[model samples]
Target: MKVRVGFGYDVHALVPERDLWLGGVKIEHTMGLQGHSDADVLIHAICDALLGAANMRDIGYHFPDTAGEYKDIDSKILLFDTMELLRDAGYTLGNIDATVAAERPKLNPHIPEMKRVMADVLQVDVEDISIKATTTEKLGFTGRQEGIAAYATVLIQK
Candidate 1:
């Protein structure tokens, strides 16, 4: 089997009134991420990682923000489509490990649900998807709660 590894990172500004979507589930928060889509930072990162591992280019290339069809679209749909692209290219996901950086709203409590949702979208075992969160030690944009960011690394095989 041929195995490949890839890494991805993404960030979105937080703003009031918008719904906070992470991984593939909604989290109650005073602020939500700003983006053309639902702005699921974790999912975007995972998508990029998977695509990169397959040497298929990045997420924005495949799913452009300029497209009207994607406006405020569900990120889970994008994740599902990304998997289809990978499968069509003769690649299968092995596992994913990801981390979200945030300052407030306590991400730990939501991790299990995030993992479940992401696993379902990727059609992988829940154990194959690992979601971790950190506070950034109150040291950066994430620490100040200006935005949220996520990093993901994935392994894929053919």
Candidate 2:
């Protein structure tokens, strides 16, 4: 078996009047992430990791923000498409570990749902995907509640 590893990171500014989405699940919060899509930072990071593992480029390459079709699109669709792209490249997921950084709204309570949602979207065992949350200790954009950021690492094999 051939195994490959990839890493991804993403950030989005928080703004009013938008729904906060992470790992394909929406969380109730005073502010939401701003982006062309639903701005699920976790899912976007995972997609980039998968694409990088397959050496097929990144999510922006496959789904450009400049395209009107992606405007306000659901990120779960993007995750599904990313999985298809990996499968087409003859790569299957081994595992994924992802972390989200935020200062408010308490992410820990929502992690389980996020894992379930992402697993369903990727058609993978929930055990294969691990989602974690953390605070930046009142530093940087995430710490200051200006934005949310996520990092993901993935293992893929053929």
Candidate 3:
């Protein structure tokens, strides 16, 4: 079997009147992430990592913000499509480990659901997906609640 690993990072500014989406789960928050889509930072990072591992390019290459089709679209669809791309390349998921950074809304409580949702989307076992959360210790944009950031590392095999 051939195995490859990839890493990804993403961030988005916080804005009012939007919904906060992370790892395919919606979390209640005073401010949501700003983006052309639902702005799920965690999902975007995972998508990038998976695509990179397969050497298929990043998420923007497949889903462009300039395109109207992605506007206000559900990020879960993006994640699902990403998995299809990986499968088409003759690769299957091995595992994914990801982290999210934010100052508020307490992510730990929601991790289990996030993992469940991602696993369902990727058609992988729940054990294959791990989601972690952290704060920037009041040191950066995430710490100040100005935005949210996420990092993901993934292993894929063929």
State every prediction's TM-score relative to the real structure. Answer: 0.98, 0.99, 0.99
lDDT of 1 by residue, 1-158 (tens): 99999999999999999999999889999999999999999999999998999998999999999999999999999999999999999999999999999998798999999998888888889999999998889988999999999999999999
C-alpha lDDT of all candidate models, in order: 0.94, 0.94, 0.95
> Compared to the true structure, candidate 3 yields what TM-score?
0.99
Residues 1-158 of candidate 3 have per-residue lDDT tens digits of 99999998999999999999999999998989999999999999999999999999999999999999999999999999999999998999999999999989899999999999999999999999989899999988898999999999999999
Clashing pairs in 3: none
Candidate ranking under lDDT, highest first, comes to 3, 2, 1
Clash numbers, per candidate: 0, 0, 0
**Candidate 2 lDDT score at position 35:** 98
Q: How far is 64's C-alpha from truth in model 3 (Å)?
A: 0.4
Off by over 4 Å in 1: none
lDDT per residue, candidate 2, 1-158, as tens digits? 99999999999999999999988888999999999999999999999999999898999999999999999999999999999998988999999999999999799989899999989988999999999999999999888999999999999999
Candidate 1, TM-score vs. the true structure? 0.98
In candidate 1, list every pair of residues with a backbone clash: none
Candidate 3, residue 138: the lDDT equals 92
